[model samples]
Structures are given as C-alpha cells and as structure tokens.
Target chain A: MDTYYKPEHLSHFASIAEGNKALAEKFFSYYGAVFADGALSVREKALIALAVAHTVQCPYCIDAYSQECLKNGSDLEQMTEALHVAVAIRGGASLVHGVQMLEHVKKSSM
Target chain B: MGDVPLLPTWGPDVAGPGLPAASPRAVRSLRSRGSELASAETQIETVSRVDLSAMPYAGSFERALRENGWARLEPAPIEIFQINLGKLCNMSCRHCHVDAGPDRSDEVMDPATVEACLAAIDRCGAHTVDLTGGAPELNPSFRTLVDALVSRGKHVIDRCNLTILLTASHRDLPEWFAKRGVELVCSLPHNRRRNTDIQRGDGTFEKSITALRLLNAAGYGKGDPGRRLTLVTNPAGAFLPANQAAMEREWKESLEREHGVTFDRLLALNNMPISRYLEWLEETGNLKRYMELLVTSFNAGTIAGLMCRNTISVSWDGRIFDCDFNQMLELPAVASDGSGFHVWDFDPAVLAARPVVVGRHCFGCTAGAGSSCGGAIES
Candidate 1:
C-alpha cells in the first residue's frame, strides 16, 4: 500500500527495492561501522569505496564511492591509488590461474 | 554537418511582437533559456495536469524543481539527455526503467514528431542532443537525427545497447556514429559477464564487449582527444550511482587492462521509479525499502542541480517537459503565455514566461550528490 517509487523510470537500487526490516537494521549497524574509525577515516572510506566498488562491481556503487572519497577530502591521487589496489588484485587473480596451465604444460612436455 | 536542417525554423517571440507559432515543442523549450522559460506562470498552471505521479513518494517535488530549475541552465548544458525516441528497444533488460522492449510500441514517436522536437531544440538552444530508444539505432530515423544535429553543431549523445552493434544490419553503426562525431554513451551493467547476463540476459555482456571494441577500434574510449566517448552506470536495483569520478578511473583501468578499452568519462546516474522499475518493485514487493534509500540519501544541495532545472525534455510526440523523467510520466510541458501562444504555439516571449509545474518526484534529483543528466549536479 506504500508507494515510494515514482514513474519517471530509471533503474532502482537494491536496498530500495528489497526493503527488508532485518536488512535495514543490519544497514544501520554497518552504516555506523562504515563511517566509524578502524584504520579507515572518512577520507579513507572514500578511497576504499573506489577500490571495493570495482571488486563488488556495481556501477552505481562506484559512482557513490567515488563521490564519498572526494567529499572526505581525498584528492584524485588517493582515489586512483585505491582503485590501483583493486586493479592489481583483479588482474593478479586472473593471472594466478596460470599455475594450472603451467602444470599441464610441464606434464605434456615431460 | 551544417546546412542540414536540424529542426524547423522557429523565432523567439521577442524578435518581433508577432512572429508565427513555432510548434508544440517550442513550448517545451522553456527548460533552457531561463529568461524566456518562466515569463508566464499562470497559463501553464491552468492547461496541464500539474502533478503526474501515480505514487505519492515525496511531498514537494514540483516546488523544489520550480525553486531550483535543473532544466533552467543557461542554454541548458544538460550532461545527459537520455532521450527516449519511443519505448521500442531491441533488448529487454529485466531492470529496464523505461520498460522498453521489442513489444512496447504504444509510446514510440514517429519521424514527424522528431522534426517537431528538432524545432524545440533550436528554441531551447540545448548543448547536447542525447538520442535514446528501444534501441535508438532501431529507429529508422535515428541516423538522420544524429546526422542532422551533428551537422548543426550540436553534441549528439546516443545511449547504445551493445547488442545492436552485433546484428548484421547494424554492423556499420560504429562507423556511422564516428563519422558524425556522436558520443557513444553505452552501458554494460557489470564488467563481469555473469552479473551482466543475469540482469540483462545471456550473452549480453559479451556482445556488449564486442560493441565496445568496435567503438574503440572506431576511436571511441581509446585515450584519444579527437574522439569523445562516455559510459553510463546505474544500479541493478534502487541506489545512487557509484561515485562517478573514481568509478570512471576504475572502469578505465580495468576495461583497458583486460579488454584494451578506454573512455573519456563515466557517468553515474541514480535510478528513478517509473515503468519497468515500477513493475519490478510491485512484482518483488520491494517498493518501501527503495523509497527509504531515496529519502535517506536525499541531498538537499544536490536538489538544486537536478537535470530538470536547466534541461527541457521533448517527448517523441512533440510534448515538452522539465526533464525526460517528467515526460515519461506524462507531465505536460509548462508553457509561458505572454504572447497568447499556447502549448502547440511556439511563441518565445510567451514561452519564456512560463513557470514550471513541480511534483513529488523531483526529490529524485535532490538526493545525495544531486542527480542530473551528466551526473551529480553539485559535486
């Protein structure tokens, strides 16, 4: 009976569309932790958002995280550095599979 | 590209006391050229259904847009137009907000309607001409519109669905766009094929990559200055776009290292509630939570920058609106009535004097980072 969504038409968000009370509570908990200090400042969260954004791989998430990073006083340099970490991990994850190929090649050559 | 008729000729009402009527679209041009947009407030209030929302999400959307005016920008430099030529798209992404698919034909705008739209563009003097559709390329006249507009020195933006490129008939689309200097605004939902496929359908992400590659080969997104290219990001469900600037860098780095793809900028857009998204909310029963996200993230600062403030949305059928969002909902384009030129009559002086009709939906733009055609309006 509650009508929150308007009809102008763009993709809706997960949290908005799911509306689970449990999730809301969890969000309240994590949202606090997300901003709270634990080796990550508000500025750092912005950078992490930029990095994790790619890892989780949501375009909307990336957009939000990028802005959050900027607002927390992180400059472009810090943001890019964070994204580099993601790129390195993502790239390394794919390349590391070469171990299987290497073992197969060794067996064949033998 | 010049000399080609981008739109029919329409003169400003101020040019002379009594110039001929332009077209219905000319009435919609009020979003741009602020001086001419709000000269007549009372007339607009009388003719159109002031509010168009089927839902009662926000209390004061119209009031906010009227006060802030996204479509009211100088010459209206709208970052994204997201023009829906009609509801007829080739691909049927489940999360499509416009509910565009091969089946939805009732809303499609014909070619004559497009010409009327061209006239409105001239009156508004908007900088970017964003062409969208079921697949904008699916429309026979899509090419002509781009060719005509680009020639007239307008920035033509096309929200391309990648699959269109893979089709045999659309094979030369990349070249056609390149020849016209059209900015290829594309979407992939997620770089990972599985994620994209789950939401968009099987093989979508792969074909998207192929389309992107074609664009890259055609000099789009390849770290080149001569060609302009951009990508759009919207959440699968209700959420604000991931931070645009950093996201842009991430997209550039990952796609390049993996697929040798690169583009100029990445635009993050928040999803609004309309069409297919509405159906999704109803079918899955998640409407309440989605609204909370929008309300919680409502950025008052961003509201002033909502795209409708300065951008005028012209429907495929010649109706005008403060933004494309408003057009989909059937909100009548506000008209300025100084010279007695009504909705269909293009009188610049009269058109310039109209006040915008605001509604509850305007809150979508006011939310965090403030949504606009390009991205965040304030940040």
Candidate 2:
C-alpha cells in the first residue's frame, strides 16, 4: 500500500511550488493506496510510470523512472525497446500530418 | 502549396527572433499597454546561452492571480510510465528540441540510478515500462534494463533509432527484441526517403528502410501478425502536422507496397521550439512568426489533453520535469527549496497539481495538432 512517489520529499516540493499543491495532495492521497502488495510486480509499475510520463511529459519523472526501470531489473535492451515506443509515438505524430501536404503537392504538381 | 491564400491563416512577419526595429510610435503604444513590463528585460540581453529573465516570475503568481483571472488547474495521474532516459542522442537533427547529440554527456542515466528506478517500480507495482533515450538502444545497459522489466512481466517499449539497428552491435537487436516481445517504435519522418533523410541525416532514410526490413523479418511492422512495430512523423518546420488517419493510411500503403515493410500504426508529432529548434527560429528570423502561429493555433482541446496532465518526464540524471522539452531548458522541477528539481524527491499528488512553468518554446506543443510524448494531441 506504499510507494516511493509518496515520500516526504514530495511534501518539501509541494510547499515550494504554488502550482503543485492540489496535484500533490490529490496524487498522494490515492497514489500509495493503489499498490498494496496486490497481484502485481514492480516491473509493471515501471512500465506504467513510463506510459504516464508520455501521457504527461514530465522530464523529472522520466529521469527517475528510467533508472527505476533498470533497477527493477528490467534488461538493458528491453529498456531501449520500451522507451522507443514513446519516441516512435512522439516522432510519428509529426509525420502523420504529411497528408495535408500530400494532397497539396499532388494538386500543385498536376 | 494548395490553391493557397496570399496570407496563410497561420503566417506572420519577422526579421529575427522578434520584429525588427519597432517604430517610435509603435514602441510608445507597446509601453502604453504595460506589456513593456515583460520586454524591458528582453532588451538588456542579445542572446545569452542562458537567460534568467525568461524565467516566469513564480513569485508574482500569488499576487497576479488575485489581481487577474489566473488560476491553477490540476489533473489525475495515469499509471503508465514512459521515461525519457536522456537528451543525449546519436544524431543532432536540425529541429531537435533537446539538442541531443554524441557530444551531450551531462544527462546520461547510469546503472546505479537504474537500480533505484527498479526499487521504485517494485514499490509502485506498475504494469508497463516504456524506456527511451537519444537512441535508447545506445544505452550501455539497455538490454539489461529490458530483460529486468520483462522478467517482471511488464510490457516493454523501445524508442528505436533505425540507424542503430544497422550498427554491428545492434545487428541482432531485431531478433533480440523478438525473443523478449519488445514493441519496436522507429522514426521514419516520412514515407519518402528524401524527406526523412534530409531531416534526420543523409543516409538515415535508407538505413531506416533497411532496419524496417530487418524488423519485418522478425515479425515486427507486419500488419498480419506477431510482435508490433510503429513509425513516427512530424512537420519539417514550424508548422502544424497533417491529419493522422490520412497520413497513417498512406504510410502503411507506401512502406508495404514499395519496401515490403509493414507497421502497426503511424504517430504524428508537433515540433516544439527549445534547443536546436529555438536556434533554428532565431537563425531564420521566424521566431516571431512561429510564436504567432502557435498562439493562433492554440487549441483548448490541446490544453485539456496536454501530456503533462498524465505523464511526467525524468532526466537522465534521475530528475523530474513536466515534459521532455522543459527538461532540456534545465528549469527547476517544482522549485524545491531552490535545490535540485529531481523527480525522486517529489510527492506525486503535489507534483501532479503543480502549475507547470511555460516558456515561448511551449508554443510547439500548443500549436496546431499539438505534440507531446503521446504523438498527437488527440483530444
């Protein structure tokens, strides 16, 4: 029922940043309760953390969880593989829009 | 290029980072508006490697909000972890926001730090692990990290650089990932080689195609069955990306028909201006133009679905950030006692609610088809 995200260090940060008050309180209130040594592995948490990072784009969370991914004993190669999913998604997002250009290009070329 | 208007709905004029030589009357008008308060500091500096003036006045928020209409909005956190291992990458693209390259070594994530990461994972009991790097494959402990997570039964994601797969050490990577069932996400920039290679590098397009073939042989990118492979795309300049569904169809058909390559999906991204991109804007005298475009395209839809609401970024050194772009700027993560903004020290609730610091560069994510770690701003 406990997690590292609920550490006292979090309180120190919340008090420092006016913006984090509500987020900190809400996240902490329910964060630790989610994992009460249920039918889950720490590796799953790393993956979930990673996905959430993309969902939010938190650099600090990415930095912290990347190492957590490894320490949980996730293999080196797999770590790269997992992270690529995020980069590929991020990078592909830009290219997917070339469609607007494609129609314009064809019409102009004609 | 389309039967276009003389003035694009999203175009602006500029000489450099800003408008050139404001007229006396214009300057007086600007001063009258009190926006001069923000630009007064911009005058003292030409372009410093680091500028504190741009740092938003955090102190004024408590005062300014009561005086105006600014109020912080908060969101809940989703349970998937996608960490940006570092900004260090093998390539320094013309528009790379993090300015990652072979020369960048400051944010490298080490093995010991990863051990701590593992502890957090176990402590959190998450079910998915997404690892990314400059070329995440370049991480010395990349394989170990993957194996560890797989051993724990978490789904693994790889932000692959297709060129890396061509390297001798990574030659067996396709098969290696196959064995581990790692989902492969590669950057293709475009379906056409010319566009991709030009933006990534001279040989990148060809190498990416080759890598796709290798992945296909490993059952990746094949729409038919087996493991998954995906490709990414983004506009080449400061502009909005095309529609996602239309582009994905074309990419699938072209890659499959031409190269016999297959992939599960295509992701479209919006390029934010930060490191190299900011430099690009300054050089091409498009900074103001780009900013205007971003403001013009600011979608309330994008603001509501911003990646920061659900995801949090971590630096290679185990620090925290609202997003990867913010990480490169070296901004503090929540300003903890003026110490370091490391993500490790923050409480999830407080950190999640914290109002994110925005900069001129944030325009990239807020522009048309807003971009973030999730590819496109779908909502």
**Considering every candidate listed, which one attains the maximal lDDT?**
2
TM-score of chain A, model number 2: 0.60
Please provide, for model 1 over B1-379, each residue's C-alpha lDDT reduced to its tens digit, 9 standing for 90 to 100: 7897785455444343454232211111112224221223322232122233333334345443444444542223433334568767777775664556676566677787777666756765667777876677877778788877887798888888878899998999887878878777787765445446655777787788888888888988876654677777666554555456655666677778987767788776666665545545444555555655565565657654556656666666656666776665666555543222222446544444565555545556666776666766764
What is the C-alpha lDDT profile of model 2 across B64-112, one tens digit per residue? Answer: 2223333653444634555677656777566665556675556678887
The Cα local distance difference test for each model comes to 0.62, 0.63
Q: Would you give the TM-score of chain B in model 1?
A: 0.75
- Which stretches of candidate 1 lie above 4 Å from their native place? A1-110, B1-59, B62-83, B336-344
| Cα distance off (Å), candidate 2, residue A60 | 46
Error in Å for residue A26 of model 2: 51
lDDT of 1: 0.62
Expressed as tens digits, the lDDT of each residue in A1-110 for candidate 2 is 46545444532654643677777787766766663324655555676677568657776677666655543334334556676777887778888888889988999995
Residue-by-residue lDDT tens digits, candidate 1, A23-100: 777776877787764564455676777798889876667766765654433444567778889999999999999999
Q: How do the predictions measure up, each by TM-score?
A: 0.63, 0.62
TM-score, prediction 1: 0.63
